[model samples]
Target: MDAPVSTSPRPWSPPPDASDVVKSIHAMLHPRNIVVVGATDKPGNYAERIWNNLIKYGYEGGLFPVNAKRESVWGVPCYKDFASLPEPPDHVLVLVPARLAVQVIRDAAASGARSATIVTSGFSELQDEESQRLAAELQQAVRETGLAVTGPNCLGNLSAGEKLFTNIDDRAVTMVQGPVAIAGQSGAIVMAIRQTLEDRGVGIGYMVTTGNEAGLETTDLMNYFVVDPSIRVIVVYLEGVRNTKAFRDACKAARAAGKPVIALKLGASEGGRAAAMAHTGALAGSIETFDAIATREGVIRVQNLDQLIETTECFVHAVTPKGNRLAAVTLSGGKRGLLIDAFDAVGLNFAPPSPGISAELGAMLGPGSIVGNPLDAGFAAVVDPTVYMRAIKLMIDDPDTDIVIIDAELPKAPHELRERNLRRVNDMAGEASKPVIYVSAMSIGFTDYTKELRQTLPHVTVLQGLDRAVTAIKSLIDYAALPKQVPDVASSSKPSARATLEKILKQAEGAALDEVDSKKLLKAYGIPISKEAIAQSAIEAIKIAKSIGFPVVAKVVSPDILHKSDIGGVMLNLTTPAAVGKAFADITARVKKLKGKPKLEGILIAKQVNADLELVIGASLDAEMGPVVLFGSGGLDIELMKDVALAGAPLNEADARALIGRTKAGVKIKGYRGKPALHEASAVKALVGLSNLISDAGQRIASIDINPFLINPKTGVAVDALIVLNNEAARQSFDKSTKGKSTKKGGGH
Candidate 1:
């Protein structure tokens, strides 16, 4: 069938110049010829701090300081302006006031500077009209001159690869150079990540903070890092993303490149969203949507900075295991118990050794040693260090073990003995394809001695804190277990179907659709709905019920009312014409007493079909993700139970089945005790059908509710359907404005 007809503004996109983006990033990362505007001799000023960092960090490139009042800044030549510089520099650091930032950028651009870092505040982040106007001018400058800008309210960036330290961080002078690259929206968070990694003797390859993100967003930097050959892992400190499509694409690219992207996302709570909005001018979109995309794109999300650091460190050294089975070896029984609990908490299974292997281990350790999973080798390993090494090797070689964890007190061992043990394990890891982790049982902090060991033996993953180590491994396994992304099916609404829906929506205008029209719209998409007819009077109702057959159901139809049962507007199991007539009269009388005296259109007569289970399938529009689908248990307590699974729309059969499997009702639907298993493919078909409707309608639809859909052994049929249109109150941009005109009142199911 032909795709839906009409125009829906496409999802947001980034800047359109690829070459310009690369050149800009290159200039930011490798600014050999630099000019610092607003330089001064004031000791505590931003300019002085930046100059000190450049000098102390041994920047081996030419630097020119711009200041009309000073002759020089810390013995470096000071130019009066960009025009006065010896030659046009590649980059400029603007330390001027917010009002003058645009003018400075204009001058820098005129002088052929490809990129500029505006170290000024008071832009759209302030959320005021005047500040927004200033931000607009700054954007104009970049657009008109083809120059790349980092921030108008930001804490600049640092490049370790080129020794180009442009940020106001003085302590960055001593940062070690390594393979991990960090891109963050918050400058302070980036600095903190660098310090935390540096304290552990982990060097950084590149560090960047896209403050305010006026010209280049964090996703832009992520896209750059995914392709950079030197970056093995990418770390992100996220508040929000302006362009969601770019962020998702970047995550996919990173996954395809075999690089792990670790993120610490804030704004999970309402208070956090408020704080995040005040801090940065971002929407702080739904946490649920973020989670769905993160899982789909293979981005590893963490709760806190510590988890972020721990996960990144683990990925740097550990190999992705083929399965979630873990073989843990701890010296202490108490520690072994702790490992079992931790592993179970994170859903990691313990792999039991085979009988032959168990016998060999039992003979090696002698009596009293537990030879099963979570093996406590007793004092045999401590007495003879060679024994522990041999046991570790045996676990690594076991077919059932995909990950090997050894909890040891390395600091207590003799220095030489510790070295020999770690070195052998590291060498063994090189030969074996599986990952081997060394968990510090003592909960010790990193010291010079440990730093030396990490630097010397980089292959063995050494992690501190037992709980943190297990949590990190769980994350690794989760990442490894993600199924390959399924190619999307051709699920768009056909032109004829779209036109039918549009006509129904137009006829109803801003009102809620009655069951007849709702069912009509759904039926166009091939979704099964119960056979029924609308009857305007008691005589007609009785006739319709008889035609539908005995044991029919009747519900009041109204454009002004929702939730017919709440108002006594529904009657079920009509066995005779007398019952149908009386039920219709009773529903009409009951709805008349409702507070607002809702308008009653007619009574619906439907054939009652036999069903083994009830299910709910729905779809709606999300501000960020566009379209979203939901599946869960259906009935009066669907809200109380809240056992629903949600995902972004345009779903294939695989995605639909995954969503269905996450609910308690799904378990019952599979087969409860002696009950026969219902056809799950029926539910999957309904979900995909709903997804297509949402995608085709796009922003024109407000919401959809299909509750208590009956599922029998052969098929699932919609017994009731409710569709709400995108009225003035339901517009996507309704909530952002502080002032608005009054809107018409309407009801939705």
Candidate 2:
């Protein structure tokens, strides 16, 4: 069978010079020489901290501190300016005030420096005219000189591979180079994440804090890290994204390279969004829209700091699970119960052991053993110690298990029995085909002995805290299940259909289309709308109702009245001409009695559909993510219920189905209780058609709301719809196409 054609908009792409930007970032991170501007001996100054950090980390690069008033900084000879330097610096660190930061960047660029990190804090984040102006000038300087600058209000960055530490953060004094790379808009967040990962023995390859993002944004740093061979996993701490296209490209690049990009996105709450705006001068757009984009790009999103650290640990040390099936073993019954609760909260279930494996475990642990998943190995394992090793090995070898987890604790003091047991388990883990994780019942502080044990047993992933461990395991499984390749969106809209839709839109007289006109647009896109027609008079309405069917619905057709039912302008179950005529008269009278006297276009007579389920499908242009589609329960209580799921559109049947499955309405439609399943395929078709309509029209249509799309056992049909036009686009398109023609007041055929 041939695949259905997609009419969704093409995926957003970064600018053509994205590769060039990445190359410049590489040069900046690996600079052979760095100059720190505004260097001084003033106690507790930013320049002093950066100087001390660079020297402390043993930076091999030629570091020259420039301060006109100082002869030397941190016991290193200081240059007066960029031009007085003996050699051209590849990167410059600007620690001067906001007013002088732009000139320093320009000077560095003019002197052959490829990149600069502006540590100055006064920028748009201050929310003042002068600061905003300074930010603009800084941006202009970067553009004119083609210098890849990092920030105007940031704490700077560090490169562990080069032993380059330019940041003012005191917590990250030790340089530990490993497989993880960190990027964030908040310097404090970047440093905190670095500390957490480092404490867990996971070394960071690079950490870049892009505050204000005057020139170099977080996306640029992400793109650079995706290509760095030393970085195996990328962690991002985002308040908001500056460039949507570039961010998507960077995430996709990481996914294509077989690297996991874990993001700790903030700004889900109202206060958090406001704080993000104040902190970085970046708009923290809708979290739903951000989540939709993240899901499509295969980025793993974490909620808190603990989840972020633990999930990163999973990716760094553990192999990807082949399936969702998990096998957990614990010695203590209480710990087993905690593990079960944590797993259940994350929708994870332990795989039931096979009969043979169960029998073997029961026999080895004696009759007291509970031989299911989360198997309690009893006190026998405690007495012999080898029981744990044998049981873990059995679970790993079980065909039903994809991943195995065992609860164990690292000894604080040296004990021969504990060390011997751990060593045997670790050796078994080394030979196991599946990933074997050692989890603690609660969050634990790492001891010197714990660190040594982890270092010695490299094959075992020790996850502390049962809740965090489950969250990490869930993330690992979810990431592995994500599609490696992004799907392509190829347009296959029929020319005639698109032309008809445009004509309907161009003819729309008001900002919002009346029911008759909205249905016309939907019908043009091959969506099944109710059999209906507009009637200018009672006699005409009666005639239209008869044509539709015996039982029909009559609604007041007015561009001004969006909610017809609220105004008592809707009449249902009109089974005769007399009923239809009275309904038409009543609807017109109700509209005339309104305070503003809303213009009544006519009466709409639509076939009354009796269905088992009602669903709402919609599409709107998001500020950051272009067009997004929504699906959920419908009817008048839609706002109250708020059971909606959103996804970036134009959607194929599969995407439509997935969107539907996220809502409770989807489950009901599939068949709730004893009720039989409705026509879900028809609903999928309507959603796809609506998505294509909005995507094709772009900004011409602002939003589309199709509520109470009635679905019977056989099929679904849109009974009511409203299309809100982008007022500016509608006016411009209307004027351009209908020049010198008689303008229509209301959309009536």
Candidate 3:
């Protein structure tokens, strides 16, 4: 069969000039020289402002203005073009149309200026076919010339140490230089965050906005950021990711570099998804999907601009909450209560300062401050603002307290005093490299001071709002604790992605398997099966019952009555031949009554096996996670609990064991309380055994339901199982079975 038709766009791609554009932004940071391609005094032109801002911002780089229309722009002499420059500038800033932006970059690249900022929009995102064609043509030019572009619609980039200047917010222009490097797709968002950083008085190393992300994607720019010694914290405002594999690799590289990447990713809703597809011609990896990959890959995803900035700071500044412990220091009763609720919601908690220290802090302040985990430093700060420092020091110094959080709003009277207190508290936290979260109730106050503190103490992550303050801390804790990758079981049997299994998984179809067929497929996979002789009639059923054993389970094994008990399709616990004969007739008769017709497949007498616990595990293809295994409470209601834990199959013993523990059944399977535990480890091995079988069989199995896999508690034998066979459905059954084994006994099976 042919592959499905395409609907999602060709992943978002910026023009080759896009990086050249971003490089232009990066160049402004420490450019040897900057050449303005469309320099002019025209009121609407960006030339005068660019020239003026370069000079005003104290850019030491030489400036060359090029405008055929003017000899000077903002009092700077203009060159006709790049050929006229005395020496090539490190960056060529272009504020021209799309067609001209390409030429500007080509000129720059030819002149050894390999980077150019294109502060011009109107390309593919505009949905103008002509413009898109032009955009593609321009992109080819940059690629051929090997120059990098930042944006055609981007606001431009920034580097504080380089003293690079573009149209970034003026407030951010005043911000100092530091280790954080921001690569944003949304110019407005990056600038806003820059402003926010500036408001907090934090210094930034570089701010790159990949407008329309035409060429130098966030990952491409980050590729350099991960290696740049000057950048410690990487913040990104992402509209969309063009290449996930590239991003995943970059994230791994960044993690190894010890650089915490805080990302503000967009495109969550249906409309947003459509826009993402259209804007960049890229698939909108949904928020949750993106989160899973990012989390797995070590990229911290944040929601809003606020989350973007705060999380970035925490990632850079704070260590993981050592032991799920937080210390909340707040003044107001309401604030403290809110903090508690927020902490609970986020799955983090305040470890009250140790009794010895809590007592000491209380004594120092006496009746003034309510010293507890949520230390009410409010009352004490009024008496001695240094009490803020004292309270913070108390929390940070506490051996049991891993994280200290101050949720307070201090007035601007004491910049020096607060800085002293902050640094003192900073020193205390620095002793053990502990983390501190400062939450200013209002967004307005202490912007400058907060910035100063964050810059001084890279680990002191500050935020606005009580909820944000709490959530950021908790998310940091949780995100840090997440495992890197679940163990892979497919490599267990060294299963080489057999063609047969692939075909089975890709295209299989069938209803539930008959018991005999289930065992036949298991036999193919090297799974053991019970010895049973099928009896064609009541006489045969009794004869087989006696031949097999006296006490046997006479089950109505027919595909018709899938739920045997509902229609009296099963007759169990029979010891005598006479009883077995009666059960054979009764079960078939009952089925006839229920369905108005019953064609007996014959009665099979199977040995009755004692079980400690029933495990139900199988696989059903999850469109998202792929052929994932499932484990849950066994018996009929396995559907109801869905108490499943899964892993992709071809599992090894270790992977199988983990798969068992991953389910709610771990404790129960291990034997809970006084009850004898099932042989989970052995059962896991059995599961691995079965999965390898399916992997080997290829196209033969659809789904395997190890329902009521009467596991012998003492010996841990998987005494009974049902393997469904059909098509690709069976290929996925391996995972479903592994995930479906149970813990809860239910009312009864």
| lDDT per residue as tens, model 3, 702-724 | 34555666666654433344444
lDDT of each: 0.74, 0.79, 0.63
**lDDT score at residue 189, model 2, on the 0-100 scale:** 78
What lDDT score is found at residue 62 in candidate 2?
Answer: 76
Residue 576 local lDDT, model 1: 92
Backbone clash total, candidate 2: 0
- Backbone clashes per model, in order? 0, 0, 52
- Candidate 1 is scored at a TM of 0.88
What TM-score, computed on C-alpha atoms, does each candidate reach?
A: 0.88, 0.89, 0.66
Scored by lDDT, model 1 comes in at: 0.74
Question: Candidate 2, which ten residues in sequence have the lowest lDDT sum?
Answer: 273-282
TM-score-sorted candidate list, best first: 2, 1, 3
lDDT of 2 at 601: 87
lDDT of 2 by residue, 1-749 (tens): 11111122212233456588877887778776778899888899998888778777877777788888877767767778878787887789998888988888888888899999888888878768998899899888988988888877778888887778898877754586788999887888788898888878787889888888778877888888877778889998877765667788788888888799999887532211111211010122357767887767878888899989989988988887889898988887888888888899988888789888988988888866568788877687777777877888899889889888988867777888878877877787778767888888778898867766667777778888888888888888888888788775544467887998878877887657888888988887878998889999999988888777879999988887766888998899899999999998888888888986778889989899998887888776654556667788888777678778888778888888999999999999889998999999989988888889878987677678787889988989999887767675334543554468662111000
Q: Which stretches of candidate 1 lie over 4 Å from their true place?
A: 1-20, 172-176, 268-285, 409-414, 441-443, 483-492, 505-508, 511-515, 556-603, 731-749
Instruction: Please provide, for model 1 over 280-350, each residue's C-alpha lDDT reduced to its tens digit, 9 standing for 90 to 100.
Output: 11222356657765667878888888777778878888898898888977777898888888788877768
